[model samples]
Target: MNLKIDIDKVQYDASKRSLAKVQLNSLWGKLALNRENYDEYAIVESNEELWGYLYDKSFEVKDLFCGTKKALVRYKTVKEYNSKISRGVNVVIAA
Candidate 1:
């Protein structure tokens, strides 16, 4: 048997990987087999500190999602980390 693949999907992921040096991938849904209650994990390594606060986990998270964990964290350079921190923003949703 032969399998068909979507070339665009592969290219999209490749581009995302290249641009998103850091990614937070979670597998809680895959693990629990429940997609409705699944949450997303984020990888953030933009600016070194984002004004010297977030780099060290200074940002407080209230009612945090305690069911998931970070899968991977990547950083191409300290400069990239700094840039992400300085220019990036995260939006948290209550579960």
Candidate 2:
């Protein structure tokens, strides 16, 4: 699947100072760059490490963990006290 990622909306946690949030609407569309059978994988890291990963890879997916309500609740609980704080969060892709 072709995906687009918005590098701007990605945010890090205030307490842990790690990648905490991602805005999905910023991602415009997912286009098929090429019809090649290349293995697709994602390397998850802290906000600190995200820059490095972005520099190395052409495309990456953020908020893979917080993509679901259950996952967001669990992840938010570990990161922050409020689960409601994570509402409206979304995953975006950039071309």
Candidate 1 on 19-47: residue-level lDDT in tens? 56433333322233433223333443334
Error of 2 at 64 (Å): 7.8
- Scored by Cα lDDT, where does model 2 land? 0.36
Candidate 2 ranges with C-alpha deviation above 4 Å: 1-36, 57-95
Candidate 1: how many backbone clashes? 11
Model 1 RMSD, rounded to 1 decimal:
17.8
- For 1-95, candidate 2 gives per-residue lDDT tens digits of 99888889777667544322223222322232222223344444455454444454444433434332222111111222343422233223233
Q: How does residue 55 of candidate 1 score in lDDT?
A: 41
Each model's lDDT comes to 0.35, 0.36
The per-prediction tally of clashing pairs is 11, 6
